[model samples]
Target: MTRRTSKLDRRLVAETALRLLNEVGLEGLTLRAIAHELDVKAPALYWHFKDKQALLDEMATEMMRRMAADTAAPPSDDWRDTFRTRMHGLRAHLLRYRDGAKVYSGTTFTDTSYADGMEENLRVLVVAGFTPRAAARAWLTAYSFTIGYVIEEQAMGPDPFAGTEGYDVEARAQRLAAYPLSAEAGREMFQDHERGFDEGIGAIIAGVEATLLRRGA
Candidate 1:
């Protein structure tokens, strides 16, 4: 019923930090802030996490745990379809909180619970005729694309596409009147991120199929 407890643990601290993250965002979230939200002294958090970054790493791990729970099993085994589904699911997971992508990026996972899932992902590629190294590279490429996309998406606003809040094609066109094509291009580029995301994943998968799978590389 209460976030406060007699004993503070790493998981509780991480979960509290995640809830606070939505309220304060990454720039405002801090170990002290999390402690205050938990109704504990700042020093109590240090017993579980050595520092703020350590706490952040745990939070990212917790996010991954929730993501994994949403997909009980991997998707279909057609390598391209499987990867596309994974990338989309990953994007949804990263969009779950304020600055979710920023919180997830560059953090070392705190445990090995992710190993089985990673192995399963790589196995799908390998079974589809990718060399182990190529499979790893391909997966990483897709992952990097999703992370970068979501970071920019969150930057635009909580709901970048609800209206023309951050990406007003007309405004962009007006600002770049000297270049009609680049100005109008904003509609294609920013007007429909869902389409862009699907196309981007498709293009990446197609490229991998053309270059790696085709060449047996």
Candidate 2:
């Protein structure tokens, strides 16, 4: 009964921590803050988590658990499509919370379930004729690109052009005149976030495919 109760408390603490992270982000998150939110003392949280990092690890695992679920739904015949869907889901989930990308980056989870999601991705690439090492490397490359892109996109704010609302197109053109290439391509450069994400994902997949083809030949 004591063990059962302890397990229950740990689960509750993890859930509450997740909620706090989504609400306040990592910077403002504290064991005391979470305890107070749960109407319990900070020491009570220590019983479950030794420190803030331990708590964060659990929270990050929870996020990956959700990602696993989102990605595990259906198998796609096209490996690229499967990978892109997973990335899209990840980006959408990360954007749901303030600083969600920051919380996810640089976090490692040894949870078998999350590993299963990655293994599934590896299987897709393997089926596409990639050697295991290449497939794994491609997965990491795609994951890194997706994470980096989301972080930058989030940092750019909701509207990249917000502050330039009053600026006329001619004025913008004049301002960018020194950089003729940028001036000519400025509109395309600041693409819709979704379009940019798709483009990046496509590029990564294409690069991996080209590498595989060259190796095969």
Candidate 3:
């Protein structure tokens, strides 16, 4: 079936932009491309979004909206566990499209869906003994860490050097022959990224709990 985008809504435009993001990434995403996908003239798109940035902002908002939906129903009552799970989930969602984290980072979401989720999650923390401000801070702290982490992890894309992004003990050893200790450190540092991600998030959650508990958050 042919899709008609003659009368477009912001949501429809944003959703189309998201599909383009998965296919062409952020750099290739353009108003013209979106128009082509929607089967409409590029000028018709401006009726919904003023410029690419406006469309991008809507895209970012839509990503958050999806994230909010994913985390809507908390599986656990333990605030720590809930926060940790959601952080991991957010990372997974952000990694879905190329430069997903960058897209989200570029714009602010001015939607109530995100706002409502924030308020509800903040209440969870507040009830768990965190002051209102502390609750917000704690969530933001986790959010910042998650986004930053996914950004870094995703940045190591497509084997930047010689198509050897996987385990290369021999190649690495030969490269670091002059510096044994540095090579060992590098090996350990880069090896087992999944473990590192898991541990890093675990530590963040534990650290937050300890700090907030000590300060009576």
Best model number under TM-score: 1
The lDDT per prediction is: 0.84, 0.72, 0.77
What are the RMSDs of all candidates, in order? 2.4, 5.2, 3.5
Most accurate candidate by lDDT: 1
Ranking the candidates on lDDT from highest down gives: 1, 3, 2
Candidate 1, lDDT over the whole model: 0.84
Better of 2 and 3 by TM-score: 3
| Candidate 3 structure, TM-score to reference | 0.83
How much lDDT does candidate 3 score? 0.77
- Model 2, 1-217: lDDT tens digits are 0112334365677667777765666678888888887777679788778877777677777778777776655357688788788888888887766567777788766366687777777888788788888888888888888888877776655622232232244556689999988786645544477897898899988898899634744
TM-scores, each model vs. reference:
0.92, 0.80, 0.83
Candidate 2 similarity to native, TM-score: 0.80
lDDT of 1 by residue, 101-195 (tens): 99999999998767778898899999999998889989999999999998887886535333235656688799999999999787777756778
Q: Candidate 3 has which clashing residue pairs, if any?
A: 129-217, 130-217
Model 3, runs deviating above 4 Å: 158-182, 185-191
Give the least accurate 10-residue stretch of model 2, judged by summed lDDT. Answer: 159-168
